[model samples]
Target: MRTVRIWAEHSPFDLKDELKKRGYRWSSGDEGRPKGWYVDIDEALEADEVRYLSEHIYRRDVDLFTQIITPFERYSVRA
Candidate 1:
């Protein structure tokens, strides 16, 4: 899964809204990280798609990490 974490030095919620404008869907992280917010691609993407997204997407000060989500986890996150 291709995922990106968008956070800021201040105004974390605003950063997440910025991510949404660029087509990323935001979610607070998995179980242990209740406060961490992120945007993710729920589906498995093709290699080329992954490359294109990573290269073309404009990122600011954000933590981009791969999110490992189970079916239940996905269901729990507020879309």
Candidate 2:
């Protein structure tokens, strides 16, 4: 599986329709920064899918807090 990070100042839901249009699956992040979502693309997804995902998911002005990490990698949740 491949991972991509997306950031937007507004509601992450803003991109939901586009995601659905492009056939990408997503999951919400854990506590704290709940406004963000993680988009997971199947390794088998086509190049067009990846390109569309990168183009439409982000807003121009917002600082997107994102990182491309593997599913097996560990991330700490700070309180």
Q: For each predicted model, how many residue pairs clash, with residues at least 3 apart or on different chains?
A: 0, 0
Candidate 2 ranges with C-alpha deviation above 4 Å: 1-3, 12-15, 23-33, 41-59, 74-79
TM-score of each: 0.35, 0.38
Error of 1 at 64 (Å): 3.6
Best by lDDT: 2
| lDDT tens digits by residue: candidate 1, 1-79 | 4343332222345455654675555345464553443445544553433454345443333334454656666577575
Error of 2 at 61 (Å): 3.3
Q: What pairs collide in candidate 1?
A: none
lDDT of each: 0.45, 0.48
Query: Candidate 2 clashing pairs?
Result: none
Give me the overall lDDT of model 2.
0.48
Model 2: how far is 49 from its true place, Å? 10
